[model samples]
Every structure is written in structure tokens, then in C-alpha cells.
Target chain A: MKTIQAVSYPVHFQDKAYKELSSLITKNGYSTIFILVDENTFEHCYPKFIPNLDSEKRIEVIEIESGEINKNIETCIGVWNAITELGGDRKSLLITLGGGVITDLGGFVASCFKRGIDFVNIPTTLLSMVDASVGGKTGVDLGVLKNQIGLFSNPEMVIVDVDFLTTVTEREIKSGMAEIIKYGVTYDIKLFKEIKKNKGLHINDLIFRSIEIKNEVVLQDPKEKNLRKILNFGHTIGHAIESFYLESEDKKNLTHGEAIAIGMVCESYISNKLLNFPETKLNEIKEVVLSIYDRINLLKEDFAGIMELLKHDKKNVNGQVNFVLLNDYENHKLDCKVTEDLIVDSMEFYNF
Target chain B: MKTIQAVSYPVHFQDKAYKELSSLITKNGYSTIFILVDENTFEHCYPKFIPNLDSEKRIEVIEIESGEINKNIETCIGVWNAITELGGDRKSLLITLGGGVITDLGGFVASCFKRGIDFVNIPTTLLSMVDASVGGKTGVDLGVLKNQIGLFSNPEMVIVDVDFLTTVTEREIKSGMAEIIKYGVTYDIKLFKEIKKNKGLHINDLIFRSIEIKNEVVLQDPKEKNLRKILNFGHTIGHAIESFYLESEDKKNLTHGEAIAIGMVCESYISNKLLNFPETKLNEIKEVVLSIYDRINLLKEDFAGIMELLKHDKKNVNGQVNFVLLNDYENHKLDCKVTEDLIVDSMEFYNF
Candidate 1:
């Protein structure tokens, strides 16, 4: 048992948490174990990772489509039926080993079986391990809408093994960085400065730091009532931008974090513009965000379409768009009322 | 505000709760409050029921195709996007005014809005108020499977107005009774005896009794860990039968409780063979179940299809078909397992 105090969950981190998890599983004497992975993770990874576990614990593998398109009622049924067909019961444990899609959908299936059973998570991607793994948000997408269906459920235990990132591509690596950067922008100015200064820093150490930042934010408010909304900082437009790109066949998706990366820049600039911060700091922010994220090109017309999509964004309360603005960065969240005009201006500035 | 203390979530069910709900929405407050009604309930009822609420609430009535076919992800997205275009948000509350489908889909949409807001359930049909209302098993169907994708979360409040049943058809009324009968067969012997005697039972009293049974089961295991599986008594095969007929263009679905009604009869026979259930008591159950549910004609070959569909039922763990067999009519529960052969025989016997 990897203990998470004042918590309903357990997680394994650093270099030692894996051995602790192995012994803990042995101590509990799990009759059998199953692993849920996506097609990408199963093919590229797992073969090398399998030998680390004891052969006596029965291991079965199940795979699904690796992206948001497959995250639906069809996939959930496929998983539930597959697990049950495989002889899964309350005693059977699930080991989710993939990115956000795998962990989110796996946790959801485990939560609903005969009411529910227990499942363990081994987030292979940095975005999942650092952000989605801790919050207990498990669900599927609702058509074009992202995470339009899900619940707050903590995993039984989490194994944040950096070894899984071996298969993650360069694009995926940057997507994960989007969220790591958000933590610095949202909560810790020191962490922000460090990330800014990480010219020669190993990405692995930054991954650990990112996970710690997420863990701290989630523990303070597990359910996301007040302090938690701060996490939505870039999501208002970030999500809208993602959905907009997702609709265009020729356009590329901004990974969960990358979209939020743009959201952070735009929202941060809004903070400066609306709150009248020093113009030099705004220029510093532009340089900082652009340095991390390559130039994103969107036409002025495209920005108008993005604003139209924003009307459908879920963050709106009674039809007005709500933005989680920052106060000099560290204070994290100041809910700002955003109009279409300001949003358009931010989009132009983002690409410029 | 409603004081409902079943087992886990204790709330004082009174006018005060409604008042608090009403006070919270003083403005035209919503773009429009939508009350989902079915064909059966709209013509037979709901006209007179609208007067009880504040006339200023700007309630809009939307009706959809009733029965299991409507509970699809396609329909969910339609309803969701429709609500969004109608200006729904964190402030708008979806009032599911009918049976399980309305509440289930409506709750799903509300829960997904900006990562969930609030939705109250006013269960018009008898089956919903007692069963579907209490347990937060909300989701839609995927292709031919049932509840293929969804989440578990309680409604903001549940309004159990027994008077709503006046609009229910005799067959619809009987369908809800199938579950009420189940509450007795699985947990309470006296409640079982009460149904056996066929005494002067008022609608209000029956609803209360059913709610009490659900409350007991839910309170002890709100998240459905151990004790909650008892509720799936007939649901294992029941859902299979319902899904089979539901998918067939030539067939009509048995109402949810009705499908489980047949499911109960067959699963009970399995309990008799696998769990050493007394034949005399099983006959008593058959007698009561048949009285409450209209007999349906099913082909002998349908058992093969039904059992095959049971493979997809979320209730099963690891492909091994797990049955919630009766330990004796009063305590149906976990630790119950039946061979696939026994499950086949039980389905065949119910048909012949």
C-alpha cells in the first residue's frame, strides 16, 4: 500500500514507488491482475515493461482506440464486457497503462461494474500522470465536446513510472509540457522561473516537479468547488480552440495541454490588459510563452469562428463566458467576465 | 434541502426542500426550464401537474420518443447540444420529469455541463422515484448494448410525488411493481409476504416501502461496493432480454422493470439450482411475478441470443456470468456464481 494520507487513494512515485507497489500487491495477495492499454501503448510499449512484475499474478491485456474519438459508450461497453467475459470480479484488479484516455476510461469502467471494483493506474504520458491521474476525474467525451461525460473518482493506487514515456513522440512530449507550464503560471512563480530557466534541465526532473504541483492543488480541494475552478484557467478558450480545430479535417489538434498552453498566454495577457499591469511584464509573458510553444498561426477570420464556438463552451454560467484570470501569476484565479471583443483581441495577440 | 435519510445520504424530505429549490431560482433564472415528458405521461398526465410550481419559472416542455431506444449517445448529444443552443449553462437546472430515461439522460447532460452543475429529478412514473431516483446510475445506450457509457452521481434532489402515478397506464403501473416485488424477494421477507397476501395496498404506502428498501441497500453502500450488487438480482439476464428485444426492429422492448421481471423469474430458477433455493418459495415468486408482468412470447432459440447479450452486461466480471442468486428469498447477494450451462437452462425454462 502506497499511502496517500488524508486521502482515499494511494500512488507510487519517484524511483522507489514501483517496488513498494509490487510488495504491496504481493502483501494483499491479488489472485489475478489485468492491464487496460490503448493500441499505441500496447504496440510500442508493454513488451519490455512486462518482465518487472511477478509471473504468478495473472495478467491479461485489453486495448481500445487511443484518442478521444474512441472514448464513448461503445468503448466503455467493450471494456466492461471484455473484462467480465475475461472473468473479472470485485477481487480482480485493473491496471490502467496508457495516457489520459486509458486511465480516464478504465477508471470509469471500474467505477461502474456491479456499482464498482478497484483499478490501479500507471499513466505512461506526462500529461496524464502529472495532471489527470490525481484529480479523480474519470469519464468519456460527448461527441465533439471534450470530457462531456465523467465523475470524480480516485484510483485505488497510481504508479507514475517515467519509464513509460519511452514511446511518447516529440509532439506528445510538448503537449504534456503545456500543463507543466500552466502550473508555474497558475500557482508557483518560483516554479515558473525555473521552467523559464530550464535550458539544460532534464525533462524527467521537470515531470516530477509538475506532478508535485498538481498533487498540491488537488489535495487542497478534491471536488473543485472554489479553489479548484482555478485549474480551469486556460480551459475556457483552450477547450474552445481544441473543439474548433477538431472540427476541421485539415487542422491539427492541440493536445490537452497544448491547447491550455495557448489558453494560459491569452488569459495572462487579459489579466494584464484588464487589470492594468506593467506593459513590460506583458512583453515578458509573450516572450516566455512563445519560447515554450512554437508560433501558432490562426487567421483573424479563424479567431471569429473560435469566438462563436466559445458560446457553446460549458464554462458559461447563464450565457456569459467565465475566464479564470491570474493575479500576477501566483494568486492563480480571479474569475473574469470575458466578452467576445476581448476574446478576439487575445486570439490575434496569441498568433502575433 | 429535502431531508432524505435512507442509509447513506440522509435528507429531510419536506416542503422546505422544495422551497429552498424554488428560492434558489427567483429570476426568469434560466433561459427556460425544460421538463422532459414521455408520450404515455403527457396525454394521460402532466397538464394538471404544472400548476404547483411558480408560474414565473418559464418552464418549457419537451417530449421525446419513449422507451429504451431513445437512450442512445446520439440522443444524449442531441439533447445536450439542443440545451446548449437554448442557452443552458451552470445556472440552468434540467428537471427530469418522467421515468428513468429522462432522469438518466437529463442527469448526464446536467452533470457534463461545465463539468456538472445541478439537476433535480421529479419522477413521474412509480419505478423511477423508488429505484432510478436513488441510485445515481445515469447514462445512455451504445448501439445495441445498454448503459454502455455513463457515470454515477446523485441528483440535487428527488421529488417523489405519488400523485404523478394517476397518469400511468395499467401496464406501466405493473412494470414498476416488478421492481417493488424484487425488493421483497431479495431483502425483506415481511415485505415479500405483504405482496404474497395481496392486501389493500395504497399507492403511497407501496412507494414508501419500495423507497425504504432501496434506502437500506443504498445507505450501507452508496458507491455500490459490496451490498449494492443485490439490486442486480434479475438485471444480469434481464438487461440481456431487454436489449435483445430493444435491438430488433420486429420486436418491442419490455419496460425496464418488465425486462427485469422476466430476468428475475429466470435468475430465480438459476438460484434454485445453483444456490439451493427451495422450490416451494420459487413457485410463490413465479406466482407473484407473473401476476405483475404480462407474459411475453419468446422463441426457444432466443435464450442463446439472450445469454450471448448477457456477455455485454456490465454486471458480469471476467466473462464468467455472475448471478445474484437468492440465498433464500429474503437475502439475495454476492458470493453467488452460476455456470453458463445453468444460466442457459434457466433462460430456456422461462421461455417454455
Candidate 2:
């Protein structure tokens, strides 16, 4: 088993991850154990997942409807009531098993349940294992706003098992890859070059390296005050575009990574124009992102909606949109203000 | 002006509080300022409060219906949306100006808003000033459960002004006194005797002493793992009684302190029976509680209802109800399990 001690908790990888989970459960001496899972993971992963653990304590299961839309206060109420109905107390242990939605919402619920109880994460998706699971950020969306309500609470531990990725769709795999690409673009040029060179990389190695890159950055700035803003390389505009598509009636729904893939391209164009980023490097980034994610075209009206959404971004300050742009590979500049006209031009550049 | 530095934040007393708040707001440089007020506070306290502080930042107000019943997810949603619509961001400042209901819910909404924003609490009621404002506990109830969902996040500062107590009703004042009496019983026998002797006590001094006792206990145990359980002396049965009345159609709603007064009497009797607590001391405690609070008759059916609610107490473990019993003056025994029949007897003792 490969173990990475994160800023606040340990992330365990490989076949022996469940063994560590069982030991943690026994050593902690929790009164009861409750598992929170979404509908999809409950069906595909629960049986294979729970049998690996060894514990005599009573284990309860709570399942919420699968998807991002279900990650709301209503679902939190249902899960909270389930724990209450099952007699969960302050000393009870909550093990969240599933992807980002499950881990994020479940983590928030656990953090707020009876002024918080002990919780561990067993992230079943690649996106969650590398990005959501490693970072201590836990929250849910409000209306069309993504991750609008939450807290900075770390789980007691995070268990990452690549075996669960076998059930994930290819689109989901590509979506998770976008975040991995982000870590490379922002911090490690060598890793970015390696990813671009090898299309069929080992999933475990990819997950570990991506998480390592994020962990190093997070350890330096846990609160996203300054240095941590670098982690938002594509997130600022990406999240706005994601929210616009999520709420739009006519547009096709974009996965988190798909929107971010487009966001990276637009942001790269802005970097090249304003930050003196090399045109060749920007082309390389666009080629890799376009090869994995389908190109998304933004119409003139869509540009207005996306730009309006950008004003509400959490990263924005005093109603100004801020972006993290790379001047050279692994040399990132944070909190750079970009004008609406320049953003529109970048969108047109992506369209071309 | 008197100041008590808590484990996490400072509680400022009298006129200097607003000055401190102004300094904090200026130093932090928040994007915007939002004040969360209950209907009562908005009508009675907001006019006086705004004149004291000096800041050029934009200040917005969000008002919710006053009282404990309104402290639920529905109110949180309303306040959260109001902040969102008014352009609240990570750098926004939330100033909670009301009683326990406002501070508890507002603190929670702020803690979860954009994964938390800076908040300052200006407690306007006596109960809130002494008990609610001192503790970092922030949350709202789920159905009949009191504080079922919450977090242990501290506000940046707490402002306690005794002038606001003038608007508080006598019944409300007595409700706040119950927690003060609990602090005396659990830690300071000297303060207990002082309260017993003086009918017309200094309100500010009393508030300060009660808060000091609580802060001392909390500093020792921030997360109620062990020593902090002593603070739950009257809360176990008190919360159950409070919840019972909250849900009952026929029973008149009991204020928190009123319920706790009855709870203290019942638990004192149990202490006398099981732990050899001084019978005369128990009688004196009962006399003081009954003199300030009107004695209410509980039927056999009400006892069953209260007992059922006790099973759902957050302090309980593995279906066993735990109590904090007084073995002697200022000596507490925590996590002591009592039989169901003994609990009924304690209720009978209170009835007599």
C-alpha cells in the first residue's frame, strides 16, 4: 500500500486501503458506523466495498439520489434525518463512499451533524480521488451556483482505490484527466510533458502524481488567501462557464472537466495576449485539451451569459473577475484582472 | 468596558464593543458588510447599534421572523439567498445582531456561505449575551431537535451590550438566569450563594461571572470530548423537556431557561438519590429555581414523552442516556448512566 500524508489527513492507495480503514475504525472506538453513498455507487460499489472491511460494530447505509442536482439542502436533510433515525450520536463514525458529490455533500453533512462527528472518505471516482478527496473543501451548490455553501473541513482519512474506476465511463475518465492536466500546467512542466507524450498512462500513477501536485500546493496555502489561488488556474472562468451551461435551457450540459477544458483554452489565450506567454506553449495546451474534450462553441449571446456569471465567481473581489494565468509552463500568475472585452476576444479565439 | 478573551475570540462589554467591531471591520477590509437581524432586534436594537459603529463599507440587512421556531433550514435558505443576491463573497463581513436564534442561525449561514466569511456577533438578549455569544457553537434545529445541525466555528469577535437587556422581558431575563445558575452549580459555589442571597443583583457583573465560568470550562475542552460534558449538566434532560414542549400541541412553550430550571431540579434529586449529593443543597437549589420559575405540573403521559425525547439526546451513546450529576458543590460526575425508572422518579420529585 502507498500512503501519502496530506496536509491534514492521510490518503491511502492500492489493495490494502480497506485494511487500513478497518484498523482506523477499530482504533477510534466509534459507537456506530454509517456509510453515505449516492445511488450509483451504492449499486455498483457498496457490496464489493463493505465486505473488505472487518468490524463488529453496527454499520448503517444512507443512499441519496445520484447527480449534481441532488447535492442540495433537501438531500442533506434526508441524510441527516437518516442518521438521526438510526440513533447516530457525536461519537458515531460516518464513512462517505462515492465520487465528488457524495464526498462533498456527505462531508458537509458530517461536519455539521451534531456539531460534527468523525468521518472518513473512500472516494470511488478518479476526479474525487485526486481533486475533491485530497483538498479539505466540502460543500454543495446553491441553485445554479456550484459549491456555494460549504466549509473547510478535512475528513479523518481518505481511501483511494483505483479498482472502482473500472466502472466509470470514458467521458468521466476524461473529465478527471482535465484536473490532472491543470496540476501539470500550473506547477510541473515535466509532468505536463509526460502526460502529453503518453496517452495511455497507468491510472494509479496518474492519480498519485496529480494528488501529490495538489497536496504540495495546498500545504503552502490551505485557505486560498494568496498562494492557493494558483490552484484555480482554470477554475475562475471554468466555473462561470459551467454555471452558465448548467442553468441554460438550450445548451447541452457540460461536465466539470469539459467546461474547465474550454476554460483553460480561453484563459491560455488571455495569458498569451496579455502576460507574454509563448504562443507555442499555448498551442500545446489547446491541442491536448481539445484532443481529450470536445470543443464547445460559445455564441455571441452565450458570451454575455458567461461573462455575467463570471462576476459572481467566489474568487472575484469587489465585483472584479480575477484569473490565474501562466506566463510560461509552471510559471503562474494569480489574481490577474482581465477585462470583459479581452475575455470575449479569448472566447472568439477558442471558437476559431 | 470589560473584556473577556475566550479560547478563540474576545467578548467585549459595554460601549467599547462597537469601537472594537469598527476597528476589526476596518482591519479585515471585507468586500461588503451584511447584518443579520430578527424582527424584534431590527425594530428595537438596530437604530441604536448603527449609530455607534463607523465604517464606509456597504452595509446590508437581512431580517428573519423572531423566535426559536423560525431557526430552521427554511430561514437559512432565505438568508443565504439574500446574501447571494446582495453580492456577498468570501471577503464579505456578516454581523449577527440579535438573540440566540439570530446568532446561532446567522453564524451557521456565515460559516457555510462561500465556505465561510468573517463574522462578528453582537448579542442583544441576556440569554444570548451570557451563553449563546460566548460559545462558538453555531447551528439550527432539525424539526423538534434543538441545535441538531451546527459547527464549532468561532466568530471573529463578540459584542455584548447590557443596554439591550432593558428591552428584554422579565420572563426572558429569568430564562437567561437558568444557565447562570447552572454555571454556579457546576463550578462556583461562591457565585451560587451570592445569587441565592441577592434578589437585586448587578446584571452586568452576573453576566460577566457566568461567561467566565463557561469560558474557563470551554478553554479546557474546546470540542466536548470529555471535560466539556460538564457544561451539559442541566442540558440533557432540559433539552428533552424543551423539545417535548416545542412539539406538543397543548403545552405552552417553555423558554430554554425555564425548561433548564425544571431540568436542574429533577437532576439534582437524582444526584441526591444515587450519588449521595447533600439533600439540603438539593432542596436549596430547587427552592431558588422554583422561586424564579413557575412550577409546572407534568402528567404521567408527559413523563413518557420527555423520556422518549431523552433517547434522541445528542449526548447519549449506544441508546444509553448520560447525565452530568453533582456529587457535591462544584463537583460534577459526567457521563453517568441512570436507569429509566430513576429518571421517572426524578420527574416525580420535581412534581412534588
**Candidate 1 residue-wise lDDT, A1-352, digit = tens:** 2234325666676456657667767876665687898878888767755766654777889988888789875687788778666766556778888998899888877776544567878888878877777888888876776666666777777877777787898778778877777787677767667877875577767776776667777889887767777778778888888888888788887677677778777887787778764566666666877787777787776887788777776566656787777766667555578777888788778877
For residues A227-254, what per-residue lDDT tens digits would candidate 2 score against the true structure?
A: 7887788888888888888888888789
TM agreement with the true structure for every prediction: 0.84, 0.99
Tell me which residue pairs clash in candidate 2. none
lDDT of 1 by residue, B1-352 (tens): 2256643333323355455457545642655576767776666556655665664755766676787678866676677666655666666777777888888877776766546667777787878877887877787765676665566767766777766777777777777887888888888877778877864677667777788788878878876668888898888888888888877778876788788888888888987887778888877877777776677877776777877787766655545666678868776657466777887787677666
Looking at model 2 chain A, which ten-residue stretch has the lowest summed lDDT? A12-21
Off by over 4 Å in 1: A1-7, A14-17, A20-39, A55-94, A101-117, A140-144, A242-259, A347-352, B1-4, B7-32, B55-62, B141-148, B233-314, B318-321, B324-334, B338-352
Candidate 1 share of real interface contacts:
0.34
Q: Give, for candidate 1 chain B, the lowest lDDT window spanning 10 residues.
A: B6-15
Evaluate model 2: give its TM-score.
0.99
